[model samples]
Target chain A: MYVDMQTGTVETIMSNSDLPVVLIVEDEPDVAETYKLWLQEEYEVRMAQNGDEGLDLLDEAVDVVLLDRMMPGLSGDEVLERIRERDLGCRVAMVTAVEPDFDILEMGFDAYLSKPIRSEQLHETVDNLLDRSEYDSLLQEYYALVEKQATLEATKSSAELAESDQYDELTERVAEMRDQLSDTLGGIEDDSDFIATLRGLSEDDNN
Target chain B: MYDLTSVLEFDALSQIRPGSSILISGPAMSGKQRLAYDILADGIDGGDGAVVVTTGDGAGDVVEEFRSLVPDMNDAQLGVIDCRGDGGDQAVGNAHVHHVSSPGDLTGIGIGITKALEGLHNAGNERGRLALISLSTMLTYTDKKTVFKFCHVLSSRLDSAGYIGVFTIDSGAHDDQTLQVIKQAFDGMIDVRDAEGGGREARVLGLAGEPTDWQRI
Candidate 1:
């Protein structure tokens, strides 16, 4: 697998612009400018008139992409391929007029939108993807702590674990994250404790 | 409530409602796959129609295992969506068997599930139990983002259809970030590991109070 290991997150990325980065890759200058105008308030919008420009603008700092599929030189599909190949870890939505076909099964887009999409749709999609990315960042940190504690438990002697200040801090961090997650998860049912959090996540996606 | 005593073989989670998606994450040899199979077979034992989308194992072998678990299993109801692309779709023992050339054919798998559910319902079972043996294999064919969407899409489908779903993954196969992202797609997750006391144990995550408490299996 070409999956890169977890070292940093999109949220942790530092850039000159404080707002999250949104890349718009459309062939039509008018459409690109429209998207830029709509998103510039909330995001640091970067316009790419073509696929090559899109690639040039893409980086780890980019949180989401509004990709046009019918570009001339390099299609949106190819740009998507290049994005994944580069492993930028950014969410992409293929906003195109093209009706989806069975071949979409093989495509790696996070979401698909028809060309007649409204501004609200764009905002909702971008917000949802950003939320997902943020949650993923927290989860990564949580698991990193849990795994660290697990490794200590597996390899260290009881006395060693008790004596090590590092181990003690590790345990504390896990507890803190558990509490944070619980607060985020809301109520838990006896039968569906774990599923309940998933329900919360689903709700978060919607709202 | 659907009884899970046959699956967990303990009281940690004795009953779970239908339409819930559970993910089991554990490193190699942690018995996660075994638990997944147990959950699916337990449903079959109780006469719920079962579907297995096997990407790593052969369909014949999977069928044999299911039969072994529930002897005199309902042959007409079990559905196997073999994505190994080794053979064409067919009916074996009057069971609904569908094949997609590869795991990349997500639409085919989706269609396969619809047919499988219909076949089971036509055979008189009102509910279905769906299990994707492992997502690690699916991740190999696509990026983490796409895999995450696939899980959400599949889970939502099962939820509306009122079916139970269980997906599994190998912990050591992917990075921590990948695991974290995919973990959000399900309603709950089961983390399996070697118990300090000597046997295998599991703890459920994504819940309130003491959700990480591990129980021996």
Candidate 2:
């Protein structure tokens, strides 16, 4: 195997302006700007006045969505539904005044932070969601592989997995996904533990 | 021909091939981890870089145990992943010892494993091998699905790099379904058992061109 045993992490090619994009979709103008003020230094911030405007601003480029759950015209829940329907992979944190109830469990938002949000809570929610989002696709692929492996194990033998081309392709795809995620997340400073772990698992795919 | 390491020392397989993964499973007190260390020691002895990911013991303790078994072992030949962090204070403070946040942080553990492998590679060693000690401990931290996914990604990475990936698990700790799901990802299995005469015996299954007979270890 051809192994590149140099530095573990491939430095993320980053400029000052290349921060992760965050979209604030609060109907309240003051609240939206407050969020912008708090996050603009670290993230590329965008503001949408309402749900309709939020939908217009929504895209793959948006890394996170600070969604107000109860808006006047189009409710935050409806907008969240739309976001899910569109399969936009952006992390959504339901910023709401309503105390969380049993029904909130059915929602697809990555996090649910009640209203009167403190700066610390907001920052943490966004950061945690963003970090989770980095591995979302990889985790999906991993679960898919497990499901496939389970099905194969029930009907077939270990030799089959070793011999099957589909299995090999899935394995290769997973490795590539991990590498891609690791490469993308290589920028942030505090992920020293993560970077070190990635380096430990590194091996040459070309061989 | 590549040596099958301590496995060959026990059962004497002719050749097991690179890029193949093996599960060494037995009862709790069957010395499964010791067998894993022996395999890693063989790789190290052959000048193949070794990556030992410990989800159970601290790296220092693991290294100490390894040195006890193989007295000539050199620290340079091995890379350690200390996943069993006790929180607050750091367990390891060296380049060779990469610490993950915790055993529950599978993503961090994944990253640590890759980084350790890269370290071995940068050290000018070409043929690298990996060993993950005790999957049972990993099972304690997360759900079966997560652990299964971890193994899938990890084994796939090892396979693409043509590194022999070895892991140990207690056969009694998991149910049949769990064991079967975990076993599907590996190329073979070495089921070790304590014989009536007090010594241990092993049976190899699904390894490329290897015998499936129960051999005395």
Q: Pick the candidate with the highest TM-score.
A: 1
Instruction: Give a tens-digit lDDT track for model 2, residues B34-81.
Output: 778877777777777788888877777866766666667566667888
Give residue B156's error in model 1 in angstroms. 11
Clashing pairs in 1: A195-B187
Using all chains and alpha carbons, the TM-scores for the candidates as numbered come to: 0.61, 0.56
lDDT score for residue A106 of model 2: 34
Stretches off by above 4 angstroms in model 1 are: A1-15, A98-105, A158-169, A175-207, B6-9, B17-38, B45-56, B64-217
TM-score for chain B in model 1? 0.92
Which docking band does candidate 2 fall into?
incorrect
lDDT of 2 at B168: 91
Cα RMSDs, all models: 10.2, 15.2
The DockQ-based CAPRI class assigned to model 1 is: incorrect
Query: What is the Å distance of residue B215 in model 2 from its true position?
Result: 1.3
**Compared with the true structure, what per-residue lDDT tens digits does model 2 show for residues A1-207?**
233458554443222256898999998898888889899888988889999999998886888899998888899889988976776566777888877853353345556788898888889878876765555445555556656655665566779878888867766765565566446644223323233223212211101
